[model samples]
Target: MLDESLLDDPEALARADRRELLRGAAEAGARVRTAVRHATEAGIAELKPDGRPRAVLIAGPGLAATGVAELLGTLAGASCPTTRLTPTGVAPASGALRWELPGWAGPVDLLLIATPDGSEPGLELLVEQAYRRGCSVVAVAPAGTPIVESVQGTHGLFVPMATAPYEPTEPLAASAPGVLWALLTPLLVLLDRTGLVSAPPEALEKVADRLDSVAERCGPAIAPYSNPAKTLAAELAEALPVIWTEGTSAGPAGRRFTAALAELAGRPALTAELPEALAAHSVLLAGALAAGADPDDFFRDRVEEAQALHARVVLLRDRPAGGLTAAPAARELALSHDTAISELEPEEGGELETLAELIAVTDFAAVYLALASRA
Candidate 1:
């Protein structure tokens, strides 16, 4: 059970969050709002073109890279291909993209490097490589860091994120799902200027509005009975989560959601695209069901041991559109196997709003799960 009483008890909830994860999560909506101001002041309004860039590359370490890749990918959508580069192992000097550039048929026209803390050996090396290759670069990091200095007069642009009251001094990984908004807003604004993505003038307003709305709905002040995030956390407790999304628009958000589940809740989650997941996940679900309880066991044992093998399927979708969502089939499949299922779809809006809704909700759920586990 979720301990509904705890959701309304500030003292109990605070005790559950040893790392103040809830604090970071709660400020996410405000963080995005703050990011908009930073992005505008950074002068990303003026971007020098690289003459129809062949491809866009976003490289960073940890959540920074993932956020950029996913957010940029969603914004850029089909306009231009995007790739995210990450370090595999710890050979700082080797860099993550050092050996991977050869496969591209042509040079990367644009490369954005983000290191929330402003320093990552691998990311620095990647920045050097982009400079050497003459790619137009935009490096987002802290002010006065090596990354900001290294990109100083080169063909690169530096967008620095100053530490704000909304952002804790802790590492970006600990502040993620919240930090992502600031890290990604500038790139979205730049992409909008580049004519690659269509971000209307009210777009940021819509995003902020959605973020604020979700925050209100899922905030600590809300009771579990009325809070969607808390309810979802309760449903996911003591069960493995298999997450799949309806379309590519929500793909990056889904990936980020899973990452939050892992980081905040200390739970591993599996995520995949639709059509593919339907076939691949069926086998795993079948085996899990087969190994455990009978499908028709209405009076099965309620022993703790019996629940250990349980799993839940979470499907994320956009609420406005209704073309070919995977929820129906996926839900049916899970129910057939006697597995629990839950679905989350953000309120109707453009791609970004949908992304914000799903992410904000899942982000809160992850924090609540972390809090509930400790309680």
Candidate 2:
């Protein structure tokens, strides 16, 4: 069970965060700035692209990469096809995952690689495959890894992944909260250079500022009643989060939240966009997971068994309250079924900034959950 008391006790929270998850989350804004600097040094910001690629293919491992692919595709909507490459199967080496280009991928396509760790042999092979196919390739990864050499040898653009000050000397988790922004910021700039996205230098700085503001509001030293992240973490105790997001950007943010919850906290969650989530999880609201469905739930043996998991609707919106939202109906339906709801909408900003805000707040929430709860 999650120790709710730890949510307010800063010292205890710090002691419990053995992996430095909180530090990772607090450095998100710094990561973005550092990542942009890396992109600049790599010449992504100076590139004069001939034109946009025929298609964009993203390849990587881990939830952070999954988030980058999803967010980039959303931002690059309708410009051209953007697909995330999944593993085809195991490589020749035992149990190593392999990624292959599609049969149709050719010279006009662009291959983008983003990974926290750059040692994957399969990714090295993927680089060679793209080179042989005559496709353009750009990659962002940690310095001095095998993939870095592969990309450089293949004559592809390579940007080093941004790392926080302590990252070089400390052992952060592979799924650390800040890794997402470090891996994502450089690519956003690269795509901006390609005329596929609108993340200019100033806008990226704004994103960094937005993230810092969220950290200030949601940091552990703040009281749970005032800290949105801590409050959300507390509300989610013994409950399964049904993350329902509204807006083009919110979809990726919602999915990333579930991924973070699972990776950092060992928490299972369900995610769907606003209108679709109402139906996708309707059965859950009406069934055993409903907060009030089982009256006997309250009197169950607390000492002998695990707590029952109920459904909590977390509505994330960056859009206005009117035509663009189904949040009201979602709240009504969930409440009618005795399911509680929590809502978070970012302050006014551009798409990327607002999206970063949502992701930052939830990232902190996931970190708090991981720190406060132990197996």
lDDT of 2 by residue, 1-375 (tens): 789899989999888887778888888999999999999999987799888899999998867678889999999999989999986555523138689999999999999999887888889999999999999999989899889999999999999999766644345555677898999999999999999999999999999999899999999899999999999998998899999999877889999999889878999999998788888889989999999998987899989978788999999997743656788799899999999999999988899999999999999998888888862
RMSD of each: 3.3, 2.1
lDDT of 2 at 13: 88
TM agreement with the true structure for every prediction: 0.87, 0.95
Candidate 2 residue pairs that clash = none
Compared with the true structure, all predictions reach lDDT values of: 0.72, 0.89
lDDT of 1 by residue, 62-93 (tens): 76567778778777878898888755774433
lDDT of 1: 0.72
Best by TM-score: 2
- Candidate 1 residue spans exceeding 4 A from truth: 1-5, 48-51, 91-108, 166-175, 289-306, 319-322
Clashes of each: 0, 0
lDDT of 2 at 263: 78
Question: In candidate 2, how many Å is residue 276 off?
Answer: 1.6
